[model samples]
Target: MSLLDDDAFPDMDSVSRDRVAPYIIRTEKRKAIDANGKPLFRPRRTQMAQVAWETRHHLQQLLYEAVTDYVREGYTTRPCARRNATSVF
Candidate 1:
């Protein structure tokens, strides 16, 4: 089953869990070690912050791209002004 299938993995709801799922699965299948086969510890706070920042930045870029695409496609519309400064009725 796919990891995105919530029914297959109900506990993968939290942001932290989603971020660490790949590492957790890899460690479970093999020894957690560095390139030199040395043991590794949990990621530091700064590392997690960097990951979060990158994720947020990527999402913002995607949203901006989608908006620009819509505008370029001429799908965006602006409402007409109901009144003008010089108009007198």
Candidate 2:
């Protein structure tokens, strides 16, 4: 059974559509839930855009972390390709 056939897909109170590729999964602040103690209604139209932006930010942070880690610990190992995807020798 396809999820589309289900009512949940069409009538999702909160949903992220596929048009928002590379930003489908929402991870950014699209709606201000608490604005001066008021509930905020998030817009489905702009949710994708916000999520995309947040995804980019997260990727950058991860890249930085990876590079920093490599720089700090790279010298411990000799530069060479691994054999059989395990041993460097």
| Cα lDDT tens digits for candidate 1, 2-30 | 36555544552332444445545444423
Please, what is the whole-model Cα lDDT of each candidate in the order they appear? Answer: 0.50, 0.48
For all the candidates, what are their Cα RMSDs to the real structure?
19.5, 18.0
- Model 1, position 89: C-alpha lDDT score: 12
TM-score of each: 0.23, 0.24
Candidate 1 similarity to native, TM-score:
0.23
Give the range of the ten consecutive residues with the poorest summed lDDT in model 1.
Answer: 80-89
